[model samples]
Target: MALIDCIVLALYLIGTLAVGLHYAGRNQRSQDMFAAGGQSPWWVSGLSSFMTLKSAGTFVVWGGLAYREGVVAIAITTCIGVSAILVGLFVAGQWRRTGVTTPAEFVELRFGRAAVQLYTWAMMAVRIVSTGVALYAVAVMLVALVPLEPGHPLRDPASGHLSLAFAIFLFGAIVVAYTVAGGLWAVLMTDVLQFIVLQLAVLFVIPLLWLKLGSGAPLAPLPPNFFSPTSDQYTWWFMAGWVGVHFFLIGAEWAFAQRYICVPSDTDAKKSAYLFGGLYLISPALWLTPPILFRMLQADADPEQAYILASKLVLPAGMLGLMMAAMFSATASAISGQINVFAGVLTEQFYRRVFRPGASERNLVAAGRWFALLIGAALVAVALLVPVMGGAERIVLTLTGMLFGPLMAPTIWGLLSGRIGMAAVTASAGLVFLAGLWVKFGLDGPLGSPVLAAWVQANPRIADVLVGAVLPVAILTVAHLLRRTPQPAWRALQARVDAYAPTPPDEHGVDHAPAKVVAISLGASGLLTLALLAFNRDGRGALLVFGLSMLAIAWMAWRVSRRRPGPAN
Candidate 1:
């Protein structure tokens, strides 16, 4: 390893642990630890939320996608950006008012303790399996470049007896240490730092790639007629459908909700959403440019395979380590954030709310910590399953999108109307699962691969995008309509929940001030869209300038988070 590589990686890890320890005490109280006492700055939470939700799979997936389709990534990105803004306008108030520690907490409040337990466990299981695969993906890349514990299972066919499972464990251990040490606070702080560093690498890698291309470096050959807009990669129908699905998927569920939950107040939540979503619309380019440009420069280079090798060939030791560190942070923070959310569900809704109502608060918190460990272990065990997860590597967000799409549409509808029953919600969830399976079996089999495979060929990401968002929402809405009227108890509960809608701050100006926030937020997102357009039109110099500007804005986000007041809530 080069000195710069080691130094950057070392510094990143050090920062991660430091942030974790920094938040350790906050977690001593379960709510504060798990949910940050419901007072985190909305903007800070929004920034962290983006990083945590995006994942290491993003570069591999989005870049590969961009290389194939060009500016279409912007459409998908816009879908989520729009969805998030809707989430801010519609869903933020109810979630904030409920004063729940986690999403499962709301389940308990809306449904029952038993349902909460089941939902919590189900979410945890999916996350564990998914996170393991994500860790494994990184392991594959590492093995491709660095000789980390040689003969590692990351090598196909397993030479030298280094098990891929062990690499997952090692990585999981790193995430767990930080997660357990600092809790949400630590996760937030470090994520901002990671976002900054990762964005730097993202911007840096582009220029280097163009230089290489200009200098006649080895590269991948694009498919015949690759640049044609009529190519399957750039089909208008596919792009539109993809974006529309995410409109519900990203807008309603997943990590963006986590940000809404973290901020200090409803008004702050709105502003954060507006600001975050505004800029967020553009981040696809900031985060996605490196991989796409890398592929373009290496057009003759097998884009995916080239990226794996390019890091070793181009990035100096320190910068390589820095890039790796940024990657690890993005992945780890994501996993740990989910773990923390699951633990809160376990301790509050499942363990205490259901099984042990009389348990002391402190004991409940300890239980959450233990639950985190258990989930981490499960992830390690499932790392071996990565090879079989099938396109799980490319569709990390989609995987999660599947989980949220159905549930979120119903929840949002309920929150707005203030009358949804647990039975209806649960039924909606069932419908969601069936939709996902159908896509996996039907379309996936036909299109993903014609030959028989052990499991369905449908990538979870595609399922996440299509079946996850569309089918379930339609089914859930119909089911809700066809079902009987709300029960008296349900109405009462809804009333109680709505009673707590946090009053908007007078000075906060939910509509006006948040507009400024949205301008900044949307401006960043706009930049991404513009960059992609420029690149597609062969405006390489213009795209470079736009990217540099985003780097500045992202820096401002980091500074905002860093200087945010602790007592804002």
Candidate 2:
């Protein structure tokens, strides 16, 4: 790597730390710390939501998959956009209207304290593992891009585990610093900036590759099944089933839902989902194009290295540095969101509710910070151990599917329906867990049912969709109805909804500081981006496009700032 690239990376890390520290003092109260006092602009929350879903793995793994599979990959990506649209229409507004800091708190409101505690611990486990996998993905990319010296102490003989551990700790520490300091405010602001950086980097690469490929290039023939959506592994039935699975997963994804809790109004929450959906509709094409082109040009290329190879082949030195910085931004934004949400759950749902019900706001905030550190440390430890788990990414996805599969039905049912007994919810969730485990692993391993195991292995994707989502939802709905559960009166449920409504803002006092900070940060990032482009002779066209985009962003930021609502009580 060039000295200039190193400097750009350092500056980005420093700027992120500054953003976190800047908001530390202002987040004195629990609400402010956990949910940004419900004052975040819709766009900020929206971009953060988009970036949370778009992790380092999306660039490396999904791009690689797209390169290998062609249009079939695009079909999988569309599920995410469809899920976002469903969330916007059915889930986001309801979550924001609940006035809860964390989804666990909502569980408590609907179910009982015991249910909330159970849900919190379960989600904590899932989130920790998920974040660790995200860290591992980033570390893999780092080791590939920035090689260690042959004799370095942290470089292992046969593997990059030691270097991977170091990279995880280094990046994890930076994420903890800002997330703990500024909480969601810092997370959202940094995410907006990070999202911009990632978009510009990928957008810049796509056109360069297109121009190169269009200039009378002879491409190798694709694999036989490359464009087919119905391969042995991914049948049309399997793909259709996953659309259902994704709908449930999107509704139950806690980190994504946390964005709704952060915004000021239900309208903003819905708008955020819409914004995320719109981005999903377009960004995947930009992200996947370069890798696809790389595959076309280099038929025998390593699929996992598609994005990295494309950048190395096409981007100039200074531009390469910016691209690396963007990759780091993707990882940082994702891990920070996960860590912040975990901290919120630990502090609000566990510590404050269980161990220290009468604890002061200051004490709760301090606990949240400590929780952030603890989670960061755990993620680093997991990253170190991840190398032993062959196919770690697939394992993480399967684990999350099993973990959240059962809970989805009960969660949505609790929100939309009344008179759902605590017993019913608990039993339904437990049954789903058992069912998912039986289909996913128990039959294949512990149960030792060769016939069932063979069937499951033959149709794994379909099994996941059925056992993980559809069947569980159906089972839970049947149980609820068979019990003849009697819902509360409509008026009674309406009263509870009203009670959870947002507190009225102060009439005279309004804070513009957050909006100002966001505007300034966006402008600064734009300048930094321009500076990086100026250093690259081939980046003039990219610079012009970036500059115009930044101007549009600045204008939008101004309008959002002016329309910013006063602080929630």
TM-score of each: 0.79, 0.91
The true-versus-predicted C-alpha distance at residue 492 of model 1, in Å, is: 3.2
Q: How many backbone clashes does candidate 2 have?
A: 0
Q: Please provide, for model 2 over 1-569, each residue's C-alpha lDDT reduced to its tens digit, 9 standing for 90 to 100.
A: 56677677778788889999988987888888878887777788889988887766776667777778776666677667877888889988888877777877777767777887777777677767777777777766666666656788988556633476677888888888898899888888888888887887888888888887887888878877776656676677766666666656666667777888888778889999899888887777678778877887888776666777788777765666667778878878888888888788889877887799999999999999999999888877877777676545475557644556676667766667775657776776787778876776688576668987898888776677667667767776776777665544323545666877654454634555556666776677667666766567875876667756776686676776787565543
**lDDT of all predictions, in order shown?**
0.61, 0.75
Tens-digit per-residue lDDT, 176-259, candidate 1: 888766767767766666665566666656666667777776666555554343443334544455555545544444345566
The backbone clash count of each candidate, in order, is 20, 0
Span of 10 residues, lowest total lDDT, candidate 1: 509-518
C-alpha lDDT of candidate 2 relative to the true structure: 0.75
Instruction: Look at candidate 2 and give me any clashing residue pairs.
Output: none
